[model samples]
Target chain A: MELELESEGGELVVPVELLYGITEELTVTVVLPFRDPFENGRLGSVGLRAKWRFATRFSPGRADAVAAVGGITVPRSSADGPQAGPVIIAGLAAGRESRRWYYFAGVRTAIHLADEGNDPGEQLLLNVAWGVRPWLTEYLAPDLVLLVEASSRTEGRTRVNGQTVDASGGEVLSVAPAFLLSYRNVMLKGGVQIPVWEHLNDAGRSEDVRILAALELHW
Target chain B: MNRTLFVLLAGFAFGVTPAAAQDAQRDSTEQVAPAAHPDIVMRVDGLACPFCAHGLERKLDALEATETVEIRLNEGLVLLYLRDEHSVSDQALTKAVTDAGFVVRAIERHPPTEGTD
Candidate 1:
């Protein structure tokens, strides 16, 4: 579940994801999003994602490792129907994991679809995160991971109703502090995204705070 | 003859005969042996998230002769216990880990345990 609060209104999102591992290097994911209740709640968007891990290295005796990751997201959310035009999202992620620490960096972009709201602008995203396990145990007690991340999303100019709208796109930077707990095969994660900076055009929308919480299960 | 008779009487009181005791010992001896159920332990990379760990577990469990799959997140260890008459190769283990989006660092074969039931 996710929620974003802005000057205009608030949005609530519930997303369901199904992922399968096809090969050692490839994975496929399907995502279906349920719309916000306050904003005419309905089926929002359906997305298909694929990721390939092309490189990896592990230490012989320790829990230290690194990997290179690449993936793409194909979105089907347009004004025409639920599964019409496609929006392309491509990104690269790299990360390292050790006994007590985790770090990651990623860059991605989203190409907007036609007739998707009033905005048809491209979005560029960059994110970096660092996480640490404060308490480590092998018992049934869940491991607690504290994470801090900084993310920036910048949007290009938009075309609304066939006319270019210069003021309809902007940039927002946010810092999120999150926590994850793993119990058995279930992981629970929650965080709040606080905007640190914003650069908006005259008519661009501004956001205040956004919150995210997700539950993952492994079969 | 008297000692043997007394021992047999004692065994009957305790719910065990000489032949039954030998069978029990043999059954236990077969448990921790490699011919029973073999266990494989692998040190894995990127067993960080529960999601990924779960995926690896599913893959390993799907393999033949797999009795149980256990993941030690803190240690980044994947343990697979195979039933009797089942075995997995090193390549299969590596492929399972990689398919689940992880890397295999090291693999070790441990003697089967007595408590796999």
Candidate 2:
């Protein structure tokens, strides 16, 4: 079980995820998110995702792996939010984990399909992260890890009734510093993303700093 | 005649006591056998966090022969103590670790030596 909360641009989003491991290398997840844009808060799109770790290498206390993730988000009614059609998502990620250090890089793309006359912006996201463990500890002991992540997001323009929405999309780059604390099977993590650069279209709202936190449990 | 019978009964009682005591001692020793050194030790990779390592613990514990498990995260080592008279194969152990999303770097077996008890 995973419960995540994020505050961005005066909007609050809460996403709950349930994940199941089918095999050591395969996992499935269901995401249900609730978003509040300062008025008429409601449930957002529902998403289903599958992750497959296809390749791995190991040496001593270190390991590296590559994985692919694919998912689909089913849109809710127009009253839910701006999303009016289903979205397809695909991504590839590779990472390495060692006793004292970790690193990961990934890219994801979301294609929003048109529904009726409303077309939402398609998005591309790129991310990189590095982490370190402050102190080495044995299992069942409290452990803490610090990480820094950088991400860039770009979105294509949206069109409604065959007319392009001038302020619909643009690009932003952000960096986040986060921490993860774990004990046995439970983990808590949080981060704040600070936008460093932005290029929005005319009348587009500039990106703001976002705060995120999550709790995860495994049994 | 009574005196002779009493002496014979006393001799029999004395003989049975030591044998029963020996049996009890053997039983106690057998009970402590499982507490000896772990039968198998595995060096697992990617055990960087306690939360992620918990899945590996659960997977290894599910093996049929496993009785108990101990993990040393800093060293990426997992110790398995098996049930008496039970053994798990290397293939099974490797699969268990792999399924838990980790790699088995190396495995060492220290099966009990015969007559060491």
Candidate 3:
């Protein structure tokens, strides 16, 4: 959900998640996605994330210290195609919750290496969840959330149609307003990406609209 | 006419008076069982947000360790009371927490019922 949908000139990648959550604050995320460039229908990656609690940790007496996270991403490489090695992310984050509102903010950077070269990307994401009505609480409540994301690239090489490409126009920023419906453990979430402003090679040509659905199972 | 009047009066009287109320028996406290245990109290390091905690809570419940799941944000701990002892091992519990992008700082065993026992 943190990944951007659009860039200045290229297509943004999307992943459909499964085995989404295998542990606490940790989720086993495997995604398979294929677009015009990948050609191969079965090209994707598997990754993991560790998120800390924002709501409960903020009360008078709660265990809400910020969180530390680390994970690896392995891509599915194919014959006669470039392979995207694993991507690693390490970062810190914190959050808080009110009667009907939840807020989260964090910063992180990814270390990715491919046959073309090694590229690192840094991003900061902020999320807000609001409960709109009691009627919305009936299994699925229609709610709204506001998101703000900012990213910059200091160094890295990118691939275009499986070839080494330029990492020009390195900085991009976006703000999005989203809506979600939560029914018990099942959450249905969707949103649109709007570019506030950014500097990039093809900066304004491509815009992204992303839809995400996730189910959280706990014991 | 006298017979009709008598019948109407009897029906009105019966409707006016409330039927004998069931005995107002007090509920016995013993009937309400106390919170059960052999419970697990797991403190996680990365549970820094609500959605993450909520998602883990759902996953754990799906696995059935859910008679009583207490998510205490203040202590950064999740206390689970199982219906039976065979719920899950400490390792499995730790794994569940860790996979959610969290670290299991500690896992403790708690007494079934509250008290000095």
The candidate that wins on TM-score is: 2
RMSD of each: 15.3, 17.0, 16.7
- On a 0 to 1 DockQ scale, where is model 3? 0.07
The top-ranked prediction according to DockQ is: 2
Q: Between 1 and 3, whose TM-score is larger?
A: 1
The native-contact fraction of candidate 3 is 0.12
Lowest-lDDT window of 10 residues in candidate 2 chain A?
A: A34-43
Residue-wise C-alpha lDDT for candidate 3, range A1-219, written one tens digit per residue = 222122213433444445543323344445444322333334446566555432323232223445666667776656214555677777666654332344555667777654345333333333333323222121112233344433333333465446555543255455555654433233344555555655555444333433332322222
Q: Give residue A28's error in model 1 in angstroms.
A: 2.3
Clashing residue pairs found in predicted model 1: A24-B98, A24-B99
TM-score of each: 0.70, 0.83, 0.49
Error of 1 at A77 (Å): 7.9
Q: Kindly indicate the candidate among 1 and 2 with the higher DockQ.
A: 2
lDDT of 2 at A206: 77
lDDT of 2: 0.80
RMSD of 2: 17.0
Q: What is the TM-score of chain A alone in each candidate?
A: 0.82, 0.93, 0.61
* Local accuracy by lDDT, each model: 0.65, 0.80, 0.46
